[model samples]
Target chain A: MPSNDKLFAYNLGEIVPLSEARLHISDLSVQRGYGVFDFVKVQQGIPLFLDDYLDRFYQSAQLMHLEVPLSREELKQVIADLTERNQLPEAGMKIILTGGYSEDGFTPMNPNLLISQLPLTLPSDEKVAKGIPIMTHDYVREVPEVKTINYSMGIRLLQEQKAVGAEEVLYAKNGIVSEFPRCNFFLVTHDNTVVTPAKNILKGITRKNVLLLAGRRYKTEVRDIRLEEVLQAKECFLTSTTKRVLPIVRVDDVLISDGLPGEVSLQLLQDLKDLEEAQMTSPKV
Target chain B: MPSNDKLFAYNLGEIVPLSEARLHISDLSVQRGYGVFDFVKVQQGIPLFLDDYLDRFYQSAQLMHLEVPLSREELKQVIADLTERNQLPEAGMKIILTGGYSEDGFTPMNPNLLISQLPLTLPSDEKVAKGIPIMTHDYVREVPEVKTINYSMGIRLLQEQKAVGAEEVLYAKNGIVSEFPRCNFFLVTHDNTVVTPAKNILKGITRKNVLLLAGRRYKTEVRDIRLEEVLQAKECFLTSTTKRVLPIVRVDDVLISDGLPGEVSLQLLQDLKDLEEAQMTSPKV
Candidate 1:
């Protein structure tokens, strides 16, 4: 059954019933997945990682040659207006830009946009504190760096990992670890080095912050990592806007750090928490 | 310069200015390219290949595990309502279904729908009658059968083809010829046989009809054809809802039919027209 609860959604240029926000059948973005967008968590009525997310989003759009008519400042205002209208404190915000409708009927011309606030249920306190288990799969994001709407395989990978009783999936191609479907994958080596896949992953905002914090305390390297290296890691973790710093206690039945969150993982989690708390107390921009 | 004249567009269930329809930034479809949709042509105020197009569209949604809240009948009615509202005589219709806002703050629970129509100009008479040149690229659709929004590479391929003065780009994978970015590829072999890629291509409605008619008069095979085989063909053609059956006079720089529209290509085009006329004039189902 579909959810009938009302939602405040912005379609085109007006606020409308969530049920009525529809896209045309011929939209190139919808028809061929020819669009790019960004997602930011709204914490205490403020959007986190807004600029970073938009920067990456626009980069992907530029790569695809999708004309984003709105200036960066204008888009920020649109997002701020959307969040204010929705009155969502701790929710998710989405901005979509399609290749728009074309007059020639073949190529896309105008871009389509929609913004909305989503209901969010955070992970239980116990799960968040104790961390979560994860599984590694030999799946790769087709365009690992860019956030685009072509994630059928990624979705399937997530489902498969969930079915196996894991919280997330860390994907690798040809035994070279790539990244998680919705998060960035990182590992700590025996030599006290923190490593992640160089650019074959989304340049996640949360992940970036984590990397910055880690660099201050430990030797950090951004390089290609093999499955063998991941399997031998002393600790593993995933990072995302929502996930923050989540430790992977086990991968594909193999225990990492004696099947418990490693010290390094816990340290990173605490660091991320401190960062979030600081942001929460900081003055509004 | 961008076109200043805008066409009327249906946004979220309401008719709106073509420049206004927009999607959210946090939508999983836009953020991760996790959505499905369909497109078809409207001719003489009627959507051509409506049923076939919708069927394939929903099939794509099914593959992605997206639920179309509207039933087939309900959706048809909605599309009809949309077209009537737009009052488009010959246009392009688009339908986009995105995984809606989710409670998890990461994944969505519902799907968003958007429908719109754009005033479209039909193919130029000279190009339709005389056919066009095409370029061959060794690229493969990541997921060959289902048409998803992962079209960055496809669009890039098209731009690359056009740069060399070609109208379309014929794709090949490991020496095997695939379809065009938005059309199905066909070839008339030296043995006078008509062939297309067996599967791995969009089951285009127009392509199916053309194959059926062509098979009635000639030995037609839907089997894998190598790039070498296609390059050695006597005549080549491409098919889509918009182009119908268009001859490929050249591939790269090699002449297909003395660098002109061949007899076989001309015959297939005529056959396609006859089939369309027959279907349109038939009594109501």
Candidate 2:
């Protein structure tokens, strides 16, 4: 039992203290790193784009062959319950489904569902305005579409990223650019054309919303973006649940168009904020 | 507290029941799948080639930027204590070091170490004698040299492997065969030369021992092995702690030679047994 002040989490159908939400050693998430997870942002006691996140969450689970124990409606109810119990309006909700305790530590048996809410702090306005530098590495994620718990490569490169003063890694393969480790990347060409890689990315909800919003105003294209074109782009930015249209001013040693936040990126950020505000006020049914 | 009959595991600095060894949901192993693990085979109360396994384990942790909390000698003592407490003459020992409870669920913090001894059942002699069929996929593991807990791709392909009547997956990039999901691949060429992939592999301890044993009697080469060469090989096999030298009779729909276990594979299996016997009697210090 924990104090009432402790944060609560939905753990395998039970609302328990976050500290008490533990998994046994036999779970494949711990043993084999076999699991998929999706994150949603909650604001003003409302989950933003919950349906979109849920849709991708189930798709990722299906691709990974993990069966979600609860139906979509039941999962929504659990999230609502957790949100009410935790009482954290501005928090991040993580829905994780893992290959359950295995007898041989290889096979996926009964799956385990763990939903946790934690405080999420977005980048400061000053940081977002200045943007961040990114390092490009020639690599590709395995099962790029499935949001599995496998981030070993990106995590392993943290030291190198820090050494080079780069905050994120943009993956590229065979001269074509993909997404950042945790975010979808978009670049504005010199002619103000917005482009993003269509293949080999974990189509982020924020990216989706940004694409929709940007499509209404800008000429958008989802195709293979080469590294050479990224350097030539007038503006560049990344999108994710945590980083909603955050700009990338530099790629490696090269500055992205004078190393300043581009007009298109800043506008898209405002557009995403407007969308979030509307969703928060209306409260999706 | 656990009953005396329960299996014991070394969690962090303390020894506890295996079932009681649990990690919070915030662990990177669960949150981000950021960790590395090495498996060792214990024969008659002795962990075979423990130094080799530990060397590789440390290498893996280093590559992943994970600082192992215990020194090599301390880890050896923990393994010895676990072996004594479990009283299992023949078993598999798993050493897992995960990015500990992260404050943000993304970064690696104080690593958590979990050491557990589990009952291991090797493939029956009959099964090994007849060998198994494997399906080759055009995929490569991220960080192929590190034994990280990122087997999601292989695990996801389990259903397809079963449908195709293949016991394991042989991963290849382009047309070059790297290794199996959990083993190092080897092939006896038509000219009776032993060959294995030199790059992009975990370099299994069993593979190391087999290479040394086989080199004594056969011409051996460690270089890039292509799928065409594998299909035309006189013999094909895989080596791991659990499967010392199990034969692979077929790759996808193509059978190797007569689709039967070859003589060289059988001889190497005998050689591996002899080496294990020596290791069991004369434990490395």
Q: Which candidate leads the pack in TM-score? A: 2
lDDT of 2 by residue, B93-123 (tens): 9999999888888889999999998877788
Residue B275's lDDT within candidate 2 is 90
Best by lDDT: 2
Instruction: Tell how far residue A144 is off in model 2, in angstroms.
Output: 1.0
- Candidate 2 per-residue lDDT, tens place, A1-285, comes to 123247999887799888789898889999999999999998867899999999999999999888999999999999999899888758899999999988788999999999999877888999988999999999988888989989988888899999999999999999899888899999999888889999999888898899899899989999999999999889999999988989999999999989999999999999999999999888663
Error of 2 at A132 (Å): 1.5
Query: Number of backbone collisions per candidate, in order?
Result: 43, 0
- Candidate 1 wrong stretches, greater than 4 Å: A1-32, A41-51, A67-96, A104-106, A110-125, A135-138, A156-162, A275-285, B1-34, B39-55, B70-125, B136-138, B156-162, B253-257, B283-285
Tell me the native contact fraction for each prediction: 0.30, 0.70
